[model samples]
Target: MKPVTFRNRTWDVAANLHLPADFDPAQTYAALVCVHPGSSCKGQTAGIYAERLAAEGFVAIAFDASFQGESGGEPRYVEDPATRVEDVRCAVDYLMTLPYVDEARIGVLGVCAGGGYAVNAAMTEHRIRAVGTVVAANIGRLYRSYGAAAMLDNIGKQRTAEARGATPLITTWIPDSVEDRKAAGVEDVDLVEAVDYYRTPRGRNPCAPNRLRFTSLANVLAFDAFHLVEDLLVQPIQIVTGDVPGAFGSMQEGRDLYDRVKGEKDLFVIPGATHYDLYDRPEPVARAVGRLATFYRKHL
Candidate 1:
């Protein structure tokens, strides 16, 4: 993998390029953009999948979203869903500039929260010929279900604080440790696994500090990643998720999304795997990647 940069308006987004070991500049290859989850960076599961795709002979890229990780933006750690969706387009822009990349066959693969943004981008960006997602989360729905009253109150308080020139409040994405996770009263098993994955060696990364700007909650609550997928997303799509208890149970969101998509779509379920298990767990991730690589190979 090699470090690279691409312009996203005023920001130079930091990204990593994964090229196959036998990559030849004289030969054009299919390309893919991999987007990470909201609280994570490119170096985590995103890089893992990107590198895996590269090994499958596609030129893949994993990038830090604006205002997060190594990327540049003001009001750091802000999770603007609109800007996050647009970042996928910017990634396509950079991929198109590569002489060895097949612009006509460009694809996108997003993980967790990033999956929703990938759907949003494909709804408007026709250059994305195919889309794939792993343990996809419709971020807006999650935010709305997370206690509307409390979320609203927090947003209001943060807005007032920002008005007074106070630093942006940050929301912790995980407990500091396993014991903390157990003590935090987390009823959802998926969230328990989430803390474990982000805080332990399973998929931890220094770049993912497990937090987001408090103001970002407003955008996440307001934006819908599937706003016009039925009308706008006509490209092929494949969604891979686990069928376990809690958030991963049945992947109702993926099923709903597939029904709404007005193009070829498939939902692959990895039996018994939870949401976070697909992040870096070797067996499940390998299964997800196999399905993804096959889908991209057929479409791209």
Candidate 2:
């Protein structure tokens, strides 16, 4: 693993570059760009998968989105859907510049919300030969779950306040604690696991602060990762999700995305895994990495 920095338009994106143990700079290798989930950083699950994929003989990169983690951007912690999609494309651009990277064989892997961003990126970025997703969650759908009227009303007020020079409101994606989750009617295994992963030592990283600008919801609520998936997503896709019921409704999301794409695709469901279980859990993650490696090997 090595630290790398590259420009994504005006911002400097920070990433970790992972290479196979026997890697030779003299030879070109297929590269995979891994995008992290919302309120998450490149150093968490994305970094883990990038390292695992590198061990499978691919040059891999896990990068921080422009406005979060170590990356440079203003109004920090804003989670704009457009920027997330563009970040993947920017990562691809960085990969194309590498002498040891095969530009024609680039692939993308996105986890959680990042999965949606990956799909969105692949919709227009033809350089992505193959795409893979783990526990995919469409940000637009999730935002809609909050109810349109209430969200629209809140967005109106927030925008008005911003126009008056008020600071951006901030919110955390997960509950502050297990008790808080239970109180909010969200005491499920998936919510608990996600809270632990982001807030505890199990998968915590200093760079992942788990906060987002509340006003950014307006952007996410309007953007759909699969807006034109049926017509634009022509590349092979591989989606991995847990079979168990959990937060984010990943099984149905995976199925919906799989059904829309006309290209060759595969949906691999882990029998007992939940949405968050695949984040850092050893067994499920290993299984997911194997499937991703096999798919990319055949396509990229």
Number of the top candidate by lDDT?
A: 2
Best TM-score goes to which candidate? 2
- Model 2 agreement with the true structure over 174-217: per-residue lDDT tens digits: 88666677788876676788888888788888898878888888
User: Which ranges of candidate 1 are over 4 A from the true structure?
Assistant: 248-250
lDDT, each prediction: 0.88, 0.90
> Model 2: residues >4 Å from true position, as ranges?
182-185
lDDT of the structure predicted as candidate 2: 0.90
True-structure RMSD for candidate 1:
1.4
Clashing pairs for predicted structure model 1, backbone only: none
Write candidate 1's Cα lDDT for 1-300 as tens digits. 999999888988999999998999999999999999878999999999999989989999999999988999887888899899889999999999999999999999999889999988988999999999887888888878878778889789889988999877887866877888888787687878888888888778888887788877888888888887888888999999888857533277777887788789999989888888888888999999999999999999
Lowest lDDT block of 10, candidate 2: 173-182
Quality of model 1 by C-alpha lDDT: 0.88
Q: List the residue pairs that clash in candidate 2.
A: none
